[model samples]
Target: MSVSEKATIICSKCSAETDFVAWKSITTDTDPIFKEKVRSGELYQCICPKCGNVTIIEYDTLYSEVDKDLTIYFVTNKDSYEKAMELLKSDEANSEEEQSGVFRVVTTRAEFREKLLIADAGYDDRAIEILKFITATHVKEVQKIKFDAALFDMQNGKYGFRFFETGKAGIFIPMVEDMYNQVVVDFSPKYPTEEKDNLEVNLNWVINIVKGNNNSFI
Candidate 1:
């Protein structure tokens, strides 16, 4: 079956209001055990007038058989997306390390858990200090993460770090403590540069600091 309906969705980037027609349908099939499964749902789709974005809004069912509402969109044209994907793949294949002002710091997962414990004990200042130490001390090791950019997690507590390559970046930190305890660090390079020459210098610097030979403050 099919029915026409309308709904509104906010654009993720621009927050512009968008309206689209919704279609509803149903499906039926017989299981091998002779049981029949009946599925009925309303489907949604939207087209953004301002951005010319076309996307599926969702599908809802009375029985709650569907797991989630599905949606999709694009920020750039097809050509741009393809080109960007190509560039990203190339960067990954070549493993070219580009430096964005952002640096990625490495800490043991146990240390991350300890940091959370410190935060829970009301040692917010100490937690922050530890993070600062970890980031600054490991700056050299962070530079070797083989990415275009990286950043430390300063918000909340010391959770993990992020690495950026090609046109994208990833957060590799696990969430600990309450939902808010995970730290988020974002780094964007001022200008793109290669890490070939500086990688060794950074590695040695981080090694020295981790070995407690360097007394520099974070």
Candidate 2:
């Protein structure tokens, strides 16, 4: 079920307060429009009626696709993450069925969107994250700059990643399927099943995994 409420938002440009629908939790099965908005990168936007100015608002929300067993918590900071965990625990307590599958926490909106795309494309997110880490590391070494990579799309057996905050922004690098396939074969067996909700599986997670396992996906 999708949970939402009417909230007043003060426009950044106009300083005008307006009523907006704020979503606390979104279920893709029941809220396709909201899901689409999130995909189109318009979910956190507020338009001022007086000045017609658009403001981007970022908040914590739970994104779920129940049938697919994918739940993601989009949180900006530690306080939001704690609050989201409390809500998730309460919901789990109230529910009769046991929850399973990929439950994750993403800090940024871009990461949230990338996770959705990964899930929709039927790719294992763990594998994709490993691939992203490898690509980002190579790029950092070659370009002498740090970059955050996200899964853009896959075509002709090549996975494309868009690097954020690079020297030249919006750069796409094509990673062949062989890299992803090798990661899955090498690391998938060692990957533990997610028993805890909101497991954060980002680049940091991958780095830790690589550090712990001597021969794991270097």
Candidate 3:
């Protein structure tokens, strides 16, 4: 189910207050247009009617794709993060049925977009994060180029990533299938044995796994 609240937002450029339908929760199955907007990073953009200036806004939203069994909490601050954690916990305790799916809490717009792309592409978020961590580590140690984020990208028939630095253009790195496959094979046994609800999988989870089984992938 999608939930939205109407609010009057003052445009930064013209100071014109525009009515905005802020989506608090989005269910992708019922709202394909919203899903596309969120995926393209344009969900929070508001165009000022008076000045035509585009303003990007950020807020906490719960995005869920029922078909994919994926739910993500896009949080912007510590308070929002805590609120999301509590909501997830409460849902787990009160729900009468269990739905095995991927649950994630992201603090950035880039991460929110990345998670959606990862889920849409049917990639394991864990393996993708592990791949990113490995690639980032390699670049830092060998190439000496520190990137802020490595976002998943698919072009033509290829699976690759676009690495972003603070002020530099994104550098594209083609996915190495062998490395990704090996990571899955190496870590599958240690991961969840049975499907569970709302499993938090991301960079931190991958880092912990790597630290414990450093030899497995390194």
The segments of candidate 1 whose C-alpha lies over 4 angstroms from its true place after superposition are 1-46, 49-143, 151-158, 170-215
Lowest lDDT sum, 10 consecutive residues, model 3, at 192-201
In order, candidate lDDTs are 0.36, 0.77, 0.77
**Lowest summed-lDDT stretch of 10 residues in model 2?**
189-198
Global local distance difference test of model 2: 0.77
What's the number of clashes in each of the models? 2, 0, 0
Q: Candidate 3: where is the Cα deviation over 4 Å?
A: 89-96, 155-157, 192-200, 214-216
Better of 1 and 3 by lDDT: 3
> Using Cα atoms with residue i matched to residue i, what is each candidate's TM-score against the true structure?
0.21, 0.82, 0.86
Candidate that would win on TM-score: 3
Model 3, residue pairs in steric clash: none
TM-score of 3: 0.86
RMSD of each: 20.0, 3.5, 2.7
Candidate 3 lDDT tens digits, 89-118:
674643747656777788888788878878
What ranking of all candidate models by lDDT puts the best one first?
Answer: 3, 2, 1
Q: What TM-score, to 2 decimals, does candidate 1 have?
A: 0.21
Candidate 2: misplaced stretches above 4 Å?
83-97, 142-158, 166-170
Ten-residue stretch with the least lDDT total in model 1 = 33-42
